[model samples]
Target: MTDEADPKGLIRESYRIEGISTGECRSIFVDWALSLGPAMTPPAAIALLIARYAAANPGHPMNAVLSDGLEAPPEARRRGGRAARVAG
Candidate 1:
């Protein structure tokens, strides 16, 4: 049942790892997101992952991380630049 969305099985393995922490799940989620091809939307991939694994383990911490991915992404914010430095 491995899907192209999770080609490396990182998300799937996260589900199987007992006592995995939220921080670890977040790191794994980032890795999984970065692995997606340009054609794959993170929301679509995350929805698929939740459907595939969440039902079996409603308590998994990965579920929260994946669910968090579904949120509207924060708008890009500039951190540092000549303008920022000048303003500061």
Candidate 2:
């Protein structure tokens, strides 16, 4: 979402936070993505967030980090007594 209509300020704050590591920002990004409404999918949210901040905040670490996170494959997990790999 755009800064003007950012409801939670999570994206805006992410760009402004000082000395935040890529890992820390990634954790916060996951939380923010999860907290979004059911209607908003993770990929869509990531795209919106990238659009909102990437160009304007070019120097922000999140720009590259967020893109990398989106491209990374989902983690594997065990379910129903069997190991299952999540399809990205």
Candidate 3:
């Protein structure tokens, strides 16, 4: 798998090479990436979910909707405890 950071950087490079704006290239790359994922890792899963949610909701802000409600990753949760429920 490609590094997550690299894809983001490639998106920026693609914009420069193709003469598109950064926003336009990012949108294109995001759309493409979201389509391919089964999202094995928590971060990847979150990213895919956010992308799909954003595509569907458009003007609605997903982070505001999820920020406080979602549990932190197991690694981030206190004391290596069981996973917490994320209320969505």
Candidate 4:
């Protein structure tokens, strides 16, 4: 199955296979940011955590479900937004 079809499982598996703690994961994410450009601020790191959590739980109720006539944030929307658009 694809990541979208089983994000939580993918995350758990990734963590297990990588032998990395959540803290380590967060640190690596920050390291990646630093390597790409500048050091990551606390706010940026928190945002990255939130984003990674969401990515690792795409089918989660909070991520997948929406109230009638209510729209998710542009970031959370399934299509034509930054993450999905970029992935596509």
Off by over 4 Å in 3: 1-39, 58-62, 65-88
lDDT of each: 0.89, 0.72, 0.44, 0.40
The CA lDDT at 87 in model 2 is 48
Q: Candidate 3, which ten residues in sequence have the lowest lDDT sum?
A: 60-69
Q: After superposition, how far is residue 86 of candidate 1 from its true place, in Å?
A: 5.2
Candidates 2 and 4 compared by lDDT, better number: 2
The parts of candidate 1 lying over 4 Å away from their true place are: 75-83, 86-88
C-alpha positional error of residue 47 in candidate 4 after TM-score superposition, expressed in Å: 12
Look at candidate 4 and tell me the lDDT of residue 70: 36
What's the candidate order when arranged by decreasing lDDT? 1, 2, 3, 4
Supply the TM-score for candidate 3: 0.25
C-alpha RMSD by candidate, in order: 3.3, 5.8, 13.0, 16.1
Report the Cα lDDT for residue 62, model 3.
Answer: 35
Least well predicted 10-residue stretch by lDDT in candidate 1: 79-88
- The digit string of per-residue lDDT tens for model 3 on 17-77 reads 5345545544655554454434254355446445545455444333333232245645654
lDDT of 4 by residue, 8-85 (tens): 343234334434455554444434434432344434443444466657654433322212113333574456558765
The sequence of per-residue lDDT tens digits that candidate 1 reaches over residues 20-72 is 99999999998988888776788888999999999998889999999999999
Stretches of candidate 2 off by over 4 Å are 1-7, 72-88
Instruction: Identify the leading candidate in terms of lDDT.
Output: 1
Q: Give the TM-score (vs. native) of candidate 2.
A: 0.66
